[model samples]
Target chain A: MIKQILNDIDQNQAEIIAGLRKLIEMESSDGKATKAQEFVLKELKEMGFMTECFREDERSSSQVDYSPNRF
Target chain B: MNEVHLKWIIPPTDFEYHPEAYNVAGTIKGKGTVPSLMLFSHIDTEAENYFGKFENPYQSTIHDGKIIGLGASDDKGGVAMMLYAVKTLLKYVPQLPYDLCVMSILGKHGGGFGTLSALMKGYTGENSIYLHPAETGHGFAEIKNISLGVVDLDISVKGKPGKLHDDLSEGVNAAVLISYLVTYLEKYNQQMRDKNRFDFGSFKGEPSFILNVGTIEAKGGYGGINQRAKCCVRIRFYKPLTIEGVVEDLSKYLKECCEKEGKVNFADVIIERGSFRATPAQVETEDPFVQLIEKKITDVTGIHQFIHQYHGGSDIRLPMLYGKSHCVGIGPACALPQQNSGQMEWISIDDYINGVKILASILFEYCNFDQK
Candidate 1:
């Protein structure tokens, strides 16, 4: 069973490579994880995962750009 | 999002909170209402503000096959890959019998208050995964279930004030008393280090407990003898050692010092602030979660990832204790250069991308999406 699975993974190595490059290319850090999170939500929803995203309450947030920026 | 800042205190007070703090979470739903798999990453950088207006901290660039930026390796790498894994799994196999939730939390670097808030919002599961900054060679490393305990202590010493011209011996100087107290406490910590019997190895080869005097303040500088001196102390200890027990012992020690040293009152050594504690946690590798995760890691990476204790504490500890969850920390093999130095940090681009593939494979198998 493991051998079959490994073979299947080998066949789709290109997709995994491309997918990783795309993820690493997106830049989100600091209090800006929400930016990257929004991007994740889009991909998940596009791929049919029931998804929800929340921004920190502005009244409590310490950073400037806490609002969701849709792409 | 501006520059990085480090809060000496674990969870800063509301007044100290940055204006840009926020949290984001999403779920890949399962067939039933059973608690889903959980993944968490902190959003904030350590202290980028110290760097001033330099190049964009959020701008990520791939150089020499590495992703360089401020939060790239520390946590965003974890966040990016965790989310990407979910996307990949769903892309190849959409239906899942179990749910998976990914959270990019704020304030983890500060004091984990953002993750605390997320917990309040009900972000948890029976088994969870955490994204740590360091790498374990096995493609995935099962974090040691145990983390060290921490306590934030605020101590003040009071003594009789006297003028600089007055006899130094006659004056019950609070500064002098506090200094004496610090010396004694440091020696006590050293003694404990030498005699620590518990072999948890949280410190690897060193003692488990550490006492750090983070800050100190006196009413007057060295010029005059002040009546009061205050200091903030942080204590790190392993399990079976509670903060309350340490504070009790500390009070007794202070009282003894006062009696032996001068006319200063023992009651004057007040514990003004306390109650900040992060307790230690441990999970056995034989648990179902561990077995499943280990198998998945081996299947994906073709390597047996070792399950061992982690050195640092994280937000997952809270949920592990309260929610009765199994949380494992794993991440890309990337070096976090000057993580809080306000300098550019880096994560291996290949490692980051490969991590996604491994995690995706694990998710695909663990969630049994293909079985459906």
Candidate 2:
């Protein structure tokens, strides 16, 4: 079953390459990752997965976040 | 004397190519050549937290017996010390048994780009040291080793979407699921600390190793249910727990939690890797070169110095990876300066001058100036 999944992805190599190029061209920086994320969400939706997006200010996820001061 | 130029592999959008960054190095020849000793310092500063935004990041001033500037402590101070030490030593000694080289490198902050380039160009040495700021018991300290490694990852979790009015059993909440993983990992890290697995040698601090979920975002309105969420995590770790090891544990944990019978349902979780394999580097405490450094610092400062592992990594780690010499870190700073925080950073003028003295003493002692 895993082999079949791998083979299917390999067969669609051209589509994968095109999608990667589109993402690279988008030039995501700062908080602009969301703009590129929309492209990913669109692809996921077309593949029949439901999706929703969020940003940093969304307080719902802050409680579970861990912030380290040092790099 | 040679100036090394590095052309950028990936140029910024506005320009075709940036001016070649350079590494400056000079060496003083010895009378009876045997092996060489090297001193290294970075020439670059963390210019901006985020680029394309305007801020007076470079303005500097002198205040309270200190030099205040952006890269004051981070490296420009060390650079000054290295050059002055060389000039004084050349004027006084004129000849030695082993050649002494002073190097100033670029790209120490971004990655070990300049150091790695110098290594590729064969600028390594037999015995080496680096100057970086660290808090010491006295006004100076040397690092036993630096064992901190880093990884940044982006993860997305997906589940079936359901209406808000529906019962909780109808769909999986990404927020809840991610929280579970976070809690588990936190406990795991604490357990590791308890077992002394996160040992920091002589360095003293709380949470010697850290795992941080820097940012997380989940979508869900009061009346609408969301099916996806994303998070970014950064982990700094010590030896025996590498980036790959952490990722492997995470993968195994996810499988055990979700794939078992009667578990919470999630269609898939994807992990996007960033800086996945930057490992830590260190030198043994008992090496002869290290012992000599300890003796020299003690003799010059007349204060007992401490040998400890640094919590952070630096370009000094690059030499150790090449296995050419025993690399150690020593610098003259009473306290570490603030970096990357748009604030005026400073290095003590006394400490800076003393640093030059300490380095000169070490170079003179290590090269056996008495014989000359």
> What are the fnat scores of the candidates, in the order listed?
0.22, 0.00
Chain B TM-scores across candidates: 0.81, 0.79
Give per-residue CA lDDT, model 1, range A6-30, as digits (tens): 4455565556444434444444333
TM-score of each: 0.77, 0.68
The ten-residue window of minimal lDDT in model 2 chain A covers A57-66
Whole-model Cα lDDT per candidate? Answer: 0.60, 0.54
In angstroms, give how far residue B236 of model 2 lies from its true place. Answer: 3.0
* Model number with the top DockQ: 1
Interface RMSD (one decimal) of model 1 = 8.4
The digit string of per-residue lDDT tens for model 2 on B9-103 reads 22112211113334455555666555678777765554434432324444445578766555566565666566555545554555667766566
Q: In angstroms, how far off is B238's CA in candidate 1? A: 2.4
**DockQ score for candidate 2:** 0.01
